[model samples]
Target: MLLLVHAALTFMLVGLILMVQWVHYPLFAQVGAATWPAYEREHQNRITFLVGPLMLAELLSAAWLTLHPPPALPSWSVWLGLVLTLLIWVSTALVQSPLHGRLSAAFDARLHRQLVVGNWFRTLVWLLRGGLCLWWLTLLL
Candidate 1:
């Protein structure tokens, strides 16, 4: 049951991550500053609206998996997963949300630069998470 939940959460997060990276970020970059002002709220709404539940589900799944380990994930995998989770928190709190705030406030070149830099953290977080998911999945298989 825990493995099933963990796998489902990982798949869902991967889908969302890909959508944000491949679709939303590019669309956001292309939108001109004038147009971006209007779009910002909707963009923020879409992210928070989708992410909140997904985050909760992920947290729960992580907790469940930690409590009841699947054989595929050894002790090291758990530590790595925990580290990735912490990175997610740090990236969201320190990097992504602040960048989102700046970008949403006023669309400018500086804001764009910040966002682009901020994206690096996002990229790292996703990569780490993807690795963790694969690790867990490998354990399961």
Candidate 2:
């Protein structure tokens, strides 16, 4: 049940990131310079509300599962999952969050591009984590 919850959170992030990557972030450049700052701030606030809880739940659950994995799941896999979850947090705090901060101040073309490109790291990590979760869930069945 815990693993199912973890997988559900991870898959939700996977879908969210894919939409942000392909749809949301790309549209930033089109929002117009005059309104970009306010738009960027609103995006930060709204997205944080949606993404923040899911991330925290996934992170805590990943840590718990790492220490007490299902009998069918290998210890190393849970460890990897935890590490990947940590990477997502680290990347958010260190990279993506700062870029959002800069964009909120004023939209820079270079920074907008960086936000779009740098986001690929988190997107890909979630994709990998989602696949791993599905594979691990299969082992239980």
Ten-residue segment with the worst summed lDDT in candidate 2?
A: 33-42
The model with the greatest lDDT is 2
Candidate 2 wrong stretches, greater than 4 Å:
none
Reference-based lDDT, residue 1, model 1 = 72
Which runs in model 1 stand beyond 4 Å of their true positions? Answer: none
Task: Kindly report which residue pairs in candidate 1 clash with one another.
Answer: 72-139
Q: Name the best candidate (by TM-score).
A: 2
lDDT: worst 10-residue window of model 1: 115-124
TM-score between model 2 and native: 0.98
Listed in order, each prediction's TM-score against the native is 0.83, 0.98
lDDT of 2 by residue, 91-129 (tens): 999999999998888889999899999999999999999
